[model samples]
Target chain A: MSARPRDPMLPRSYRIESVESELPGGEVFSWTLRPRGGELEVGQPGQFNMLYQLGIGEVPISISALGEDGTLIHTIRDVGGVTRNMAALSAGEEIGVRGPFGTAWPVAAAEGHDVLLVAGGIGLAPLRPVIHHVLANRERYRRIFLLYGTRQPADILFRKELERWRGRFDIDVAVTVDRADASWRGDVGVVTRLIERGGFDPRNSIAMVCGPEVMMRFAVMSLERRGVPARQIYLSMERNMQCAVGYCGHCQYGGHFICKDGPVFPYDRLEPLFDVREL
Target chain B: MDDLAQVFAEEPFFSGFSDAQLRRLAGLARPEVYQNGRYLIRQNGSADRFMLITTGHVVLKAFVPQRGMVPLETLGPGDPLGWSWLAPPYKWHYDGRALERTEVIAFEAEGLRQAMEQDHELGYRLQKRMIEVIAHRLQAARLQSLDLYGNPAGDLP
Candidate 1:
């Protein structure tokens, strides 16, 4: 029997065009990818792309931004083998790309409601597109509150855009770090502390959060205690995903696949899974 | 009961219980011994009681044909072994096997439930204690996941 073609869900080819460090500590890195055809499947906010460097294997990386031209953008932290290789890729080097999978942020539902975006450390990557979309169509939403936290000021990703977002009238941005540096003058504590100071109206707001699972859990609890309905609290989950198509069981949590059913899920639907460790 | 109080005091779940309350709780606990490789509870079996290890180790294993009896976690002295007894659908979620000759104090769930129902203040205190135990375990699990799957981010040696 003729062997079936390799699944289309797997990327055929990828070329890294350039790399840059947005943060001083060299922990968080960004890359510009040049696909062979100079084209990529357009993805919505909160979806992620599976990136593979030849011989190194694959990882799920959120597409950080949509360029005015067509180049896809990714912001990655140097945390693992595949990522370490990805950060080292020079211009014209080959990599692989798959997906642009998982549910996107509820940008449509978020329209007309006050939007509260919470991110910690590299958690900001998944929320980047939503932030861009809201700012690009600024009048669609009432108010936008962005609460971000990192281990330290130096660990914050997209520092430049954070400044720009801070300047916008409708966007109220608060940044906190676990430890403050000499040049940093902002609140310091857990990210939940920033949420307390932001004073969001949970009744009319839809809150989107992405971070370490513990932080997300705490943020969800804080939001719920402050009156945000579980349905209105959305979370972006990070799990090991070998196949973006949901065939691999690596990303299964309860009945949902983190690669297919989420990356973003309504908090209420995910409550049971949250309680079970290693799900 | 007083003899068991020292064991209870050393357990993380009961550490928060006052010496007096823990002594009182020990009154209701019954010590049981198991040989190495014995099954303490089987997955999907009835969960009529909760167990707190006093000595030796137990392995919480879940059956998977691909990897028979995948060891999920190891519980040593002081860890509460079953959470199923707390709520209905009271069936053991995973198989528990004695990794070594083990001794544990088994607390009858129905008895504790009755005791709590009879005393609102005690119920609230015990419930609060259980919540703390659950939270601590959840935190440890999350940290373990980060260590296994997360980027070390310069924190690792």
Candidate 2:
């Protein structure tokens, strides 16, 4: 008989391998974790894990990338007590991790179609895995576009990666900033403006967007204007998730639990609840 | 200027204009080119004309005393460049600079305004379309001011 999956309620210890600050003030950073247990369960793109900070608290963080040596990576923005404490952790420090939970981006189903990824600020972390996946299986898709927008030039995430992607011939990458300094020479506007110049065939494209709620709302409108069906577009959602297993009522949205049923959902499925006031 | 009329007809901004209306607009338009770093319009300068970018980019900027030129937005090909010509005082509020070798169809504001007064139907259609463009830019500006991406709240899954 097949082995039953391990209990997700219990947390597994993971040692921090390295910590790199992604932004100027160290408010945003990435952590490479090594499982104290045998092997780490790799999370698919858009899936998240409950990162427990010992006795302090636990927060759900999206898996940014999967290391070749069975390690897991997560990029976090330090905002709350839990995240601020987690950011204080150094290499070799230990943190508890549970799950590779929730739904994933429809990478496999996107085969044979054009793929568009729109990310804003820290939202790019969750979509990075999908970018890696598509690039690994490049021949399976027709056209690939990555349009990223940040609050300012310094706020841009994965600068080197974005540069390398921009250099690539197969995939199209565009970066924009809400506010530009004298040094920034790229596009200056909301990310939706990039959609106007993206040059992708909306009818044959599958778009996955992760960003601020208002930005995503405007992006959906822009994508619809470009003729992409609502069903073909997806969004990564965020909420206050406590259990990460849907047991707690914290992350419930309308009829679904973001911890279990989503975190990633097609726009059509969430359209009804998307703009509903105070939902 | 039949060729120019065809170009105007092709632009989404002029989509509702009748063929005759496009021809009338084309009569007031003349192709102009600006090299990189050239100013298309200056702050508090006469807004004698407006432009429709045919190629390259234009950066909208406002100069601050300590910070120098701060870019507000970048307008690309097929984008409208100025609306200050439509109102009283008729002076540009900010600076418009060519980010690259840009080609634009510059329309004589005085001629267009006179035509609009004589042809109310044409004026109404053009004004309505301009209002839409203005509204879109206003919406974008509102979203930008929110600093949505900078807020760390709801950032985690």
Q: Which numbered prediction scores highest in DockQ against the true structure?
A: 2
Stretches of candidate 1 off by over 4 Å are A1-7, B1-157
What is candidate 2's lDDT per residue for B112-150, written digit by digit as tens?
Answer: 999999999999998998897798788888888889886
Task: Candidate 2: list runs displaced more than 4 Å.
Answer: B152-157
State each model's CA lDDT, in order: 0.78, 0.91
lDDT of candidate 2 at residue A61, scale 0 to 100: 93
lDDT of 2: 0.91
Q: CA lDDT of A110 in candidate 1?
A: 91
Q: Candidate 2, residues A103-130: lDDT per residue as tens digits?
A: 9999998999999999988989999999
Which 10 consecutive positions of candidate 1 chain B have the poorest summed lDDT? B148-157
Q: After superposition, how far is residue A210 of candidate 1 from its true place, in Å?
A: 0.2
The residue-by-residue lDDT of candidate 1 on A63-177, one tens digit each, is: 8987666677899887776776667777788888887888999999998998999998788888998999999998999889999877765677888899988987779998766
TM-scores for the candidates = 0.64, 0.95
Q: Which 10-residue span in candidate 2 chain A carries the lowest summed lDDT?
A: A180-189
Q: Candidate 1 clashing pairs?
A: none
